[model samples]
Target: MKKRFLGYPNWWGEMPMAVYTFIEKHDWEGRTIVPFCTHEGSGLSGTERRIQSACTGAKVLKGLAVRGSAAQHEQESVRKSVSSWLEKLHL
Candidate 1:
């Protein structure tokens, strides 16, 4: 976390514990962090806001929260959601 990731500009994937730990321990002065999460029904659990608060000076783009089951049973829907989110973030 304190160590820079160097060439990376952004982070993705369901907000894994490792990412949470990294954010908590790091100072993302010039980076952008996106925290997405998958759940049974509970959504992001506020990790996005928390991430923004934790990573000072970082550009924390809006996060994505999707249900875990959707990926297995509704692939196209998940694809659309991801596509839209990426577009909205201009990523």
Candidate 2:
């Protein structure tokens, strides 16, 4: 027997196909899709746009960008933002 990685080992490399499938699957879901991305410096990196194109019927909200290192300290901000967005969207 050989050792094999069950999940995608190179997620970034497969992101395009993954995004396409995600978009196709969620296109008809009548809910807002909010993305929160943690990056070293690149921020959301246009992921919101990609998600918007993928999720046709859902309104993709402006995503939050938090430094991966700073995520622990950003708990309050994340909570507040999500709460505000949910309230605004009435979701």
Candidate 3:
């Protein structure tokens, strides 16, 4: 058997339609989903719930939201934040 991982996404405009469509098209049962995104200000406003609603059988972990400006201009800090978040989850 093999394992797969989906990299973090960029959340925008309250609900990211592509992410929603991806979720809707796939079978997420028996999987772990950790949602992290960068946004201008929406800041993961409704994506977590959207993901939950779409993939009911998957385990959705707490999501991390970083400002889009920070993600673009503050690479080191974003890296640190992601590293710290992963550590906390023991990933």
TM-score of each: 0.72, 0.55, 0.81
Better of 1 and 2 by TM-score: 1
Model 2 poorest ten-residue lDDT run:
1-10
Residue range 1-91, candidate 3, lDDT tens digits: 1222443445454555766677788888888788787778777776777777788688777778888799889999999998998888667
Q: Which candidate, 2 or 3, would have the higher lDDT against the true structure?
A: 3
TM-score of 2: 0.55
- lDDT for each residue of candidate 1 in 4-57, tens digit (9 for 90 to 100): 321111224235566667667765898877656667766766666767777888
Alpha-carbon local distance difference test for all models: 0.66, 0.55, 0.73
RMSD vs true structure, all candidates:
6.6, 9.9, 2.8
Question: In model 1, which runs have C-alpha deviations exceeding 4 angstroms?
Answer: 1-17
- Indicate which candidate wins on TM-score: 3
Model 3, residue 51: C-alpha shift (Å): 0.8
RMSD of 2: 9.9
